[model samples]
Target: MKKLLLVLAGLLLVGCQSGVELRHGYWVDLRHPAQGARPRIKVIVIHYTAEDFPTSLATLTDQQVSAHYLIPRQPPQRDGKGVIWQLVPEQDLAWHAGSSFWRGATRINDTSIGIELVNNGYRSTLTGREWQAFSPQQIASLSALVKEVAQRYGIRPENIVGHSDIAPQRKQDPGPRFPWQYLAQQGVGAWPDASRVQHFLAGQTPRARVPVEKIMDLLQRYGYPVTPEMTPGQQQTVIAAFQMHFRPADYRGLPDAETAAIAAALLEKYGAAE
Candidate 1:
């Protein structure tokens, strides 16, 4: 009876302390929270593992490369969730994106979550490069995972991007066939406004003609690695990257009417938001 009374007294004492909780015999104050200048996280960069599942696991686990999570192509049924294999802790910096930049942020691995998807990357063909299609099931799983991570980190939809979006010069994983539009429909990534695109696509633009400088400005506004000083070859790579994300039906890297329309729409929608 005396021990019971002492326990009640201790509970009463804790209940009286302002904004304090006695947890595991330790008093924790809830008033003060740790403050930081930049958000601990700001983006989620998705990738496609160039090799198969086993090779991907081996590579990501290797000291030379790493990622926060890995999703295999032939994922086991997960009752409707994405097949996620955690390779690194969320708090630790993963060496997945090498020499990456986006939205003025360099060395992106420091402030982003990397998700590596099991894929063949790309196939070299007689004509040029051929991209492999992702499984519907895998995409569904990825959609769910993307939503959860984005919500947890308060990451904007536009900030969820492919690795190639950050490093177009030497990287193109999560290629054009990756169905970014589907993810965008599910509210995971950014997609240009269809009405606005249709307006430009129908050749009913407000301007008499859109110039190369306008297209470049739109691409830059949408966060592509493009600049006025870039060489023609360098600019083409960035344009190809942009097309792969927004206008996958035609990604020849040339400034076509369709590409310009898509770029303008994206600029009006996402760039304005940013």
Candidate 2:
């Protein structure tokens, strides 16, 4: 009897080890993974928390808003390297990128990983709004994290974008002070070719008028969500979002020749869909 009980226990243990039990009296063999499926992650969205690390941590972990990762303005060092926080697991969805659209994908939160940087955003001063710059150490850590994530998921350069780029009409978290060009240089995101931009410029001055309609088409082609029904002011917000990523020197939402040229250059290089 004792020998029979031991055998039964061993058989149950072997069955449990061999198959994953489902809640509804089903068992799945995970030894053979389905080849037809793909990684859910398609894009990487960067953001700036308008609060410090402690506040950002509390908000991301406890509040409705959350991100996969949180990068401090000044990261804590470990083994002579800066360390970042991972609030949410990569396999799970986070509540970031609220009501966002990118390329042809809507509800961007479903298919993208969010990385929030600890930044004060901007303070309204008597002169103007002063934007806080990200620290070098912070950017270094962020670049490493972004590169690893992009490579793991085989994400395209154009797919790595700022929060503002995904939701131009309502959001502007990673502002002008964010070093997009520098990050692009580190193979984490896209940057328009200067020569291509000049080709589109065609010797046109910066202030030269480019048809607003044409600019809108170029922006839409590059994956910015610009609808024909949007007001003129609303359209300018989209342009400003693009400028904030590619041309951080100024982002007044003007549809100048230079802005149009940059948009054209990006389309030529990246070849967006619709």
Candidate 3:
């Protein structure tokens, strides 16, 4: 009787462990009530895993780091359809934005929801290899998700940002390849008026002066953390990140006449909220 009881106990333990493992595989919910008053979810920051699907799944579920959702590269079904996996609940902070800031708000994970997509970023580039484009199905799913989250939390369209936007000095995931213009056309995020910016750039005089401090101030107003104490090199890099998102013509880190004009135009458009 004692031997039989021991065998049954071992079986039960194995079964429980298997169940936990299965739950950890994908779309596991990690919601826990926050210790303090609930802050508003005003931003929806997007990121790319910079890893394959299996690795992303493991990392997100390990309790060391997490995001609210993970969109798989390949469709979950054998029929080649894409799926979005819900990892952490929207109400919980998911260790996604580390030591980050936006528009004077620091430690963004407390006030934002993060969505991570599985992509290897630029580090996985191979010579002569074509980069993979975001699948149509994936984009459709992401659009729907963003609309739902934005409406649910009252998040502004401009608040949907890439991880690179918040941590320009330290990180660059969801690279230039990510479709910002498409999302803007769908009314999910902000996009500057390209024609007006171009027109302003064209009409600049050779002796015309640009207020560098004012441009930087506008960037700060638009939720970029630029300080007066930043070194020249740091300032250049931050400007480059800004251009990467908005201009995309060239991220040369130089605030030339054209760049300044574009920045000024953007300020005119979006700085009212600031």
What are the candidates' C-alpha RMSDs? 3.7, 3.1, 10.7
Q: What is the C-alpha lDDT of each candidate?
A: 0.82, 0.91, 0.76
Best by TM-score: 2
lDDT ranking from best to worst? 2, 1, 3
Better of 2 and 3 by TM-score: 2
Instruction: Report the CA-based lDDT of candidate 3 relative to the real structure.
Output: 0.76
Q: Which ten residues in a row have the lowest lDDT in candidate 1?
A: 203-212
- Tens-digit lDDT track of model 2 for 40-128: 99999999999998999999998688999999988999998889899999999999999988997899999999999999999999999
Better lDDT candidate (2, 3): 2
**Model 3 lDDT per residue over 164-208, tens place:** 788989877677677888888987877878786777678776225
Encode model 1's per-residue lDDT on 76-153: one tens digit a residue.
Answer: 776645557899999899998899888767888999999988989787999988788888877877888889888988
Report residue 5 deviation for candidate 3 (angstroms).
47
RMSD of 2: 3.1
Give the distance in Å from residue 152's predicted Cα in candidate 3 to where it truly belongs. 1.1
**Most lDDT-accurate candidate:** 2
Off by over 4 Å in 1: 1-17, 20-29, 34-38, 79-82, 201-210, 272-274
